[model samples]
Target: MTELTPREIVRELDRYIIGQDDAKRAVAVALRNRYRRAQLPEDIREEVTPKNILMIGPTGVGKTEIARRLAKLVDAPFIKVEATKFTEVGYVGRDVESIVRDLVEAAIRLVKEQHGRQVRGRARAQAEDRLVELLSGATKKRKSANPIDILLGNRPKEPELSPEDRDKLVVQQDDVRTRLRAGQMEHEIVEIEVEEVRPMSEIPGMDVNMNDMLSGIIPKKTKLRKVEVREARKILEAEEEDNLIDMDQVYTEAIDRAEQHGIVFLDEIDKVAGRGGGSGPDVSREGVQRDILPIVEGSTVNTKYGPVKTDHMLFIAAGAFHVAKVTDLIPELQGRFPVRVDLKPLSVEDYKRILTQPENALIRQYELLLGVDGVSLDFTDAALSAIAECAWQDNETGENIGARRLHTLLEQILMDIAFNAGGGDAPEVTVTVDKEYVEKMLGADLHRKDVRKYIL
Candidate 1:
């Protein structure tokens, strides 16, 4: 994150998303500001709050993608929730506070994963020791049917056994250790006792923290089961890893990370933009916005882990306000998101670039998919232009779905080729898609006025 400047962040985003430079730049600067804040003195740093951004754009124009990619770039905890999925307090739907709780959960998971990598070596060594003990015990039980032979008696057994026999038992145990390390006994079945943790109940409207506490207090049940050595190693490794890490430290760092660098993307915010009638769903719309205002402006949310502070967390809201404008939102909520970025509607040229320019371009993706079946796909320059043009026309004629139209257009064009790629009657080993081939598949439909209804 410290190595990534604003320009570098934008460059990375360009690899997956085409166009939307204004939105890209806004997020890049916002992310760089986070780094800048961290460098400041503690007293002054606490005063600096993230200038939350509100991205106004149509759907499929990279609104959500920009926020998502920015989170990945900085390795920040990110959660995306639609505004419509939440309702005001007293309603049966999810409350807005769940967003913060969810973000904390993501942070805990991320931090735990990092800690796991750090302790993996020690965990593996410990697991190997346990596996060897299990295997050794199994070997001893097979050799002697007497339970007393396997169990330690008050008297020493060394005096009863001949020195030669004792030496042979030592060599046998050493050989078992050697084979265990070599993975030669991975398929050998072993009986082991495992503690089973009861799953938490999923009762709607229940406080998540209470459920967590209840589950923690419940005693775990243990049972014996036979599993292959390889499978047992994995389960024991996870258990050992958990025992090696300090959960108190993990929780502290997770909370700190969530407060300082977390990102919550509130999508479809337009759904909550009321028409100001203050009746029916409109009342709840305005109410939900009011509830979200405090969190965006800075507040504390209680989670099962602990209370998470939202003061410095970045909130990037997005809405395709085709029916309602930004002003329809409550004034307080709008004021919290000061940085507003409007993503331009995609054009035919943008569509062409999206098909071939991005690192994960649709054309490259299709080529790789077919290549796995010993079939190669080649798209001529003119063919790409025609496909882009078709997508642009469909968007213009129908719902104006922005860049998403390409997925439908390309899928329709290659449906037959994809279905028959590995079949008996597949195309040639090398298949080229030219302008003529595209036209033969879609030209008639492209000319029809009712194509939008069917193509979409």
Candidate 2:
């Protein structure tokens, strides 16, 4: 991440994406800008704000992919949210702040994993110590069973062990540990009590209310469980390691990581961009945009965990905006997102490139899927051309779903191949889809406007 230049970033994106050089260049420069800002002095750093981008494009044209790949490039906390989903349940819908909560959760998990890798040596030592304690307890308990008294034909025996006997038990404990590590006692089940974490949903504002109203009426019970030594060691050691970690520090570090490297992709922004407002859906839509505006413009949002400031967080918003122009958004919201990049619709050549050029091309994906059932699939150059042609034709006839049309076309073309793929050892199937093949598949049905509507 630190070493990658804007050009290198674009090069990386080019491997997966076919074209859309403008969008790619915009994101690449944005990413490099983050790196450049990091090199600046602390005094000026806080004054700097991220230039949030608003991507205007139709569906399935790599708007989401660019943002998604940008997140991966920097190992940032990335979250994608649709504007429509928020207005469904009024205030009960997932609060916009939950996006920050999710980002924090992602940061915590990422940091915790990195810390786990860092503390592996210490954790292993702690686990071994616990294993030794278990072995010692088992050895002492076994020896206290009084074999001497049983051999004497008198079952009576003292429960307490002498200090000398305890010393011998310690030696036996070491021997047991040696055997344990050697897998000499793998089948032996040792009962051990282990605590399990329960999923507790914290109701916002309920704590204060509950304490005042129901404190004396009820008490919360903690949770616990029982398991074997092997399982318990892993669980307890992990628990102990988390306890060893400073959560306040973790939170601070997580917030910093999120602030510095977070990527928020706001999808379907145009859905909420219209000017009309009332008691109907438009009111809620406007409300949603207003709510999102403050966060985008740099305000502190309170979450269940803590408050996260959105000032420096990178926001990449995308919308088809076919019905609504970018200017349709509220002025304040529009001002917050200063950088606007309009993505061009994919041409026939672009569609063809998408199918054949990318690492995870549609053709390659379909071939791999069919190959799973011992089927060999190969598309002739003509067949590939036919598939692309049909995809383009469908888009022209129906909704222009961009590259996604390839999915439907390929699925229909290989329906039989997918269904009977694993039924038997199939022969090598080479599909040659030329102009004729495209016509045959589409047939006269494409010309029937109503038929095309229903079929598509």
Model 2, residue 340: C-alpha shift (Å): 1.0
Inter-residue clash pairs, candidate 1: none
Give the range of the ten consecutive residues with the poorest summed lDDT in model 1. Answer: 138-147
Colliding pairs, model 2: 383-433
- lDDT tens string, model 2, 1-456? 456898999999999998899999998988888888888899998888889999999998999999998888777888888877765335766656666777777888777766777777687677666666665673223333254555555544446878998898789878877987787765555544444444555564222233434434443332444456677667767866876677777778788888788889999999887754334446677788887877788888665446788888999999998888887787899988888898988887888889889988887887787767766666677666666766777777778788998887777777866787675556655554455655566566345342466664
Write one digit per residue (lDDT tens) for candidate 1, span 1-456: 456899999999999999999999999999999999989999999999999999998889999888998888777899999999998899889988889888988988989999999999999998887887687752232322243533433323323558887687667768888998887998999887687766667655544645566545544456678999999999999989999999999999999999999999999998899874444557878899998998999998877677889999999999999888899998888899899999998888999999999988999999999887778999999999998888878777777888888888888889888887896565559889999988888866576454557765
lDDT of 1 at 187: 95
The TM-score measured for candidate 2 stands at 0.76
Global CA lDDT of candidate 1, please?
0.86
User: Candidate 1: deviation at residue 44, Å?
Assistant: 1.6
